[model samples]
Target: MQSTISYLWHTDDLLGQGATASVYKARNKKSGEVVAVKVFNTASYMRPREVQGPGRQKVLVMEYCSSGSLLSVLESPEHAFGLPEDEFLVVLHCVVAGMNHLRENGIVHRDIKPGNIMRLVGEEGQSIYKLTDFGAARELDDDEKFVSVYGTEEYLHPDMYERAVLRKPQQKAFGVTVDLWSIGVTLYHAATGSLPFIPFGGPRRNKEIMYRITTEKPAGAIAGTQKRENGPLEWSYTLPITCQLSVGLQSQLVPILANILEVEQAKCWGFDQFFAETSDILQRVVVHVFSLSQAVLHHVYIHAHNTIAIFLEAVYEQTSVAPRHQEYLFEGHPCVLEPSLSAQHIAHTTASSPLTLFSMASETPKGLTFRDPALDIPKFVPKVDLQGDYNTAKGMLGAGYQSLRLARTLLDGQELMLRGLHWVVEVLQTTCRRTLEVTRMALLFLSSSLGTDRFSHVAGRPEIKELKEASELRSRLRTLAEVLSRCSQNITETQKSLSGLSSELLKNRDQVHEDRSIRQIQCCLDKMYLIYKQFKKSRIRPGLGYNEEQIHKLDKVNFSHLAKRLLQVFQEERVQNYQAALVMHGQRMRMVHETRNHLRLVGCSVAACNTEAQGAQESLSKILDWLSHQLLQDMTKGVQTSPPPTDPYPNPEPTDLVLHMQELCKEMKVLALDLQDNNHVIERLSRVPTAPDV
Candidate 1:
């Protein structure tokens, strides 16, 4: 038998069980790899007659998670305090990500609860939660109605409950919104360590809980007291006061719960709406801290409109340091803390390490330099201009321009500004890459929405043309991202090389002419730095600032004209079924863009190294050639003249010559390697796709 087939998998240690399947801990004997095996119970009548082997059994194998389920953690007495706000949000984020994935694939996981959420321990000891149990999962076809009433009772949507209670021959079908409702319930349970509407005690407790879920409002939603919205329903349930959640969090949570748990399916929160709301709330409610000193640290509960002035006040309250005295440095440069500037705006601008804040009051320089905070904010906030001409296509164009500008900055001869520019580029590249993924997802969603009959009114030839254009733009932007990523990597390698050379030069300061090489390399690095700064000033800062302002303005302008145009398009009858093609094209573009950028920066440092190598090669060649001539002269003298007691070329002895030759050889080898590396870098740069003209 094959090793895979012969490998004994021990499945006796049971982990957990549900109505449909039993999970057991197992280990592969051959590989010693641990796994979880879930065996589904199949009735004799349901078993397929064609399945004659062990494969006939309904079983699924998956990776084992040591931390177990979220339900287990919540129920455990050790975790009575429940998860911290950050940890809880992380869990919710993971679940949301999974749900988003499911929704994208046109599948609905009817059961989304704490028990179904498993935590996997990473190598760093950090826990990553994953959604499991697809037993109640179903794929919905276009125009197909979902009518099944299968799911956990406590977590079921009010719509589902109504359908179940009515017992009609045919009821209104549920959509992907039901899954979101389940998530809301799961989040509530995770946060409070107890179900929201489920009542305790009484003979018919299950029925009562169902009734409360279907009919009653959330306890937090009541105007004055933690009671039902309509009237005080007689139930033996006590709200868990142990949650100790912040007012800001509670405010966000209440509305989210209300939206999800709405009785009308039409009123229920969609995936996109839920994601945006939750993401915003999570960002605001979270307290981010900046460690000024070991003894002095400042923390602020972030809000949408939090300004630099507010942050400084929070810090001053913590450390008794005034705003003027509190100089914030990020990556060794002073951070601008403008009173009118919003924290979110700064975050978008400084994509590198936006949260990182270093106080430089004690070690302040003679003249404190303050950067304009407005310079950092993007001119176009895409979210704000949702209904404008500055759509996804325009956004990509802007991103591409920024990337190209960054690449140009790296190559520019600005030694003093390179360091800061390099830092900015690194941050920008990371942020852009992440944003690209989100853009891809959005494109997918847009394609899906436009393809269906729901948008048939506007799905005309012009709209199809626009969609196609967007797809192509997305492709171009992805390519630009790749190029930028590769360029960033190359820059890193070049920096490392420069650092090594600098260190070597520092150690050999007394060596003849070594000081000159050191100065040259330093000059080269300075130029690179200057180039980076110029890039930031000319490209990054202006682009971001302009974009932010434009977006802000567009956001404020009533997009009534744009809305009218869309409405007009929708009314047109010449619309084509081009959505499917557009979607496929987008998917293909996404796949292609996954390829990493191979563009490399041909820095002045590489050029300096090449010059140094050439000089060394020439010098080495002369020394070797001179040594050969001396040896040849000595051999001729021995043959023609009487042998002298003293050796020829004795001022620098033969032993010394050999040692010098060895040293020269070593120097030449180092030079050769440097030249080879430079060649490789140049080759990479040559292969980079040319940037589109701005």
Candidate 2:
């Protein structure tokens, strides 16, 4: 599969396009078999040397399935969103069998969306549905909670669904349970022919579904016949899997399948167990379903596993090589160190290579680097804006997480407490900084056109006083951000104090110091958690504020607001800067028209003099030429322009026109000066251009 592009894969035809990547049909020049190739559009790995992550260079590839996704086949009008009992079993059996193949190779398909599962067409008859889009799939290692939320919306499992909404990356300790959740979602989707948790409707439906995944119970839709007493207001569906699937396949898949989709994640089956039962039923269901050949099924399994293994290995390899003192090594196994280093260093460093025993050190290593002192250490590195009222919020949160971990260790022994606290100050302080950065990043993201939808919440009650409370809405977020900032500052200060005291305590070996440190860490943690809860609650946006009456009363206004926000996003400052000179040029042209009209309106015949007329004509003509050139420049450079009829004004004032022209001239001068300053900044930031040293 890796050696050649199969015939089924054609780059010209698009198989799919999603928020983060695009898939195309492409054929291997050497292989006649068809295949699907997905090229990720994420920039995480695409940044220049300073920013690139592992796999940034690799283009994801998959085999082409002729049958499209099982999702499309089931949802198409021919089926009307529900497959016949017999046929549904066939599909289930095939999918499980395919999944079994993947598990055998230690691969878990993280994203089991219907769109990702495809069918292969055969010359003689109908095709076998093959799973594709292995981009999110990963190999099974040690049992660990999964991190990183990546998947299609309609098919996301509860865990990923929750994390994505919260915009938090899960710890890498994730295991096969993620795959099971996806499988459950896929099966549920197949049965109902609709998304699992979300009701198809307004735009906010997605966010609501995400929130539910995080904080709410499983809706009746996926919960089956055990209806929630809360009743009709809640969205629920019966157990579509048991009802729609055949008895044989159901019996085979039910055990592990139930575990995969368990409401309680801890109960879910891992990849190994899921594979065994699935492999046992492959033969029985393959013929009844698509009559898929054993060789192809095996190929799918082998290929998926190998792909995951290679990719994961690649990620680990790249991360392990990062500067040990500065990098967090993300969420994977900490690298094995050579025996030469101290046991403590070995436990800490992510370096994978082993060293000889002679290299071990008894105390702090001389060559090891410290955090940059110039950056004020923790003060500058926090994810939250520490300057705000919530400055200590993040520190409090860090202390909280540390305190929780410290509970087990502190109870273990007094010596252990001392050892752990010594490390805790360093680790927690660092973590606090990173968390601050992440939180600040999230806020920046939120500030940048990330939120604003109010209709999704109030579709049924737009005129509700709460729904129309814009000031209230802004206040909620503003208060949350402020709270977060304050908490972050407190945390930072506490961390700084901890760091300063650590040297003295460690040197003196004081028992009292150890106890105080533990208490401080615990207190900080409690505060951080409180702030986080507040932040999470603030996520309930303007969309959910409306009741049925308000929705009906102010639907138009809500929609208008939504539209305005949408337009304003495109009209943001960065975009404006990109086309600033051109926009100014156009404004100047309008001013020329205004100036001519103003003179005409007045008795003064400014153009009556030949010199005046020539000057006015030349000035207007030069400005026009500049406007045309600027537009051309923007188009050639891929800068954005307003759409046709997007002009801000149709009838500008004559005086306003003259004023705009003058403003344009002033703006051009300022722009030139700014450009010069930018050039200097760029030069300062860049490495000096130098000849190679001999």
Stretches off by above 4 angstroms in model 2 are 1-12, 30-34, 42-57, 123-126, 168-172, 199-206, 213-221, 224-237, 240-258, 271-694
Residue 87, model 1: lDDT of: 72
My TM-score estimates for the predictions, one after another, are: 0.40, 0.35
Q: Which 10 consecutive positions of candidate 2 have the poorest summed lDDT?
A: 290-299
**Tens digit of lDDT per residue, candidate 2, span 71-126?**
66754422433455455555667777787778668776777877777876668774
Model 1, residue 514: C-alpha shift (Å): 59
lDDT of 1 by residue, 1-694 (tens): 1123423344457789875567877767767788777666654224233221245444566778889999987764323334655577778778878877887788888888888899988899777999987756778633456766766666777667655544445557878788877887787777765566644442135554455544566433411122433444443222233453433355566677767766566667777888888777666634343332211122355676788677667656654556665544355344555778876654332222333332323321111111221122123333433333233222222222222222222122111122222232343243334333333332332233223222122223262343344334334434433443444455455345435433442342223222132233233333333332333333323234667656444433323223223223322310111222223323322222222222122323333334443444445445444544554565557644433357453245444544554554454455445445554554444332221110
What lDDT does the true structure give each of the candidates? 0.48, 0.42
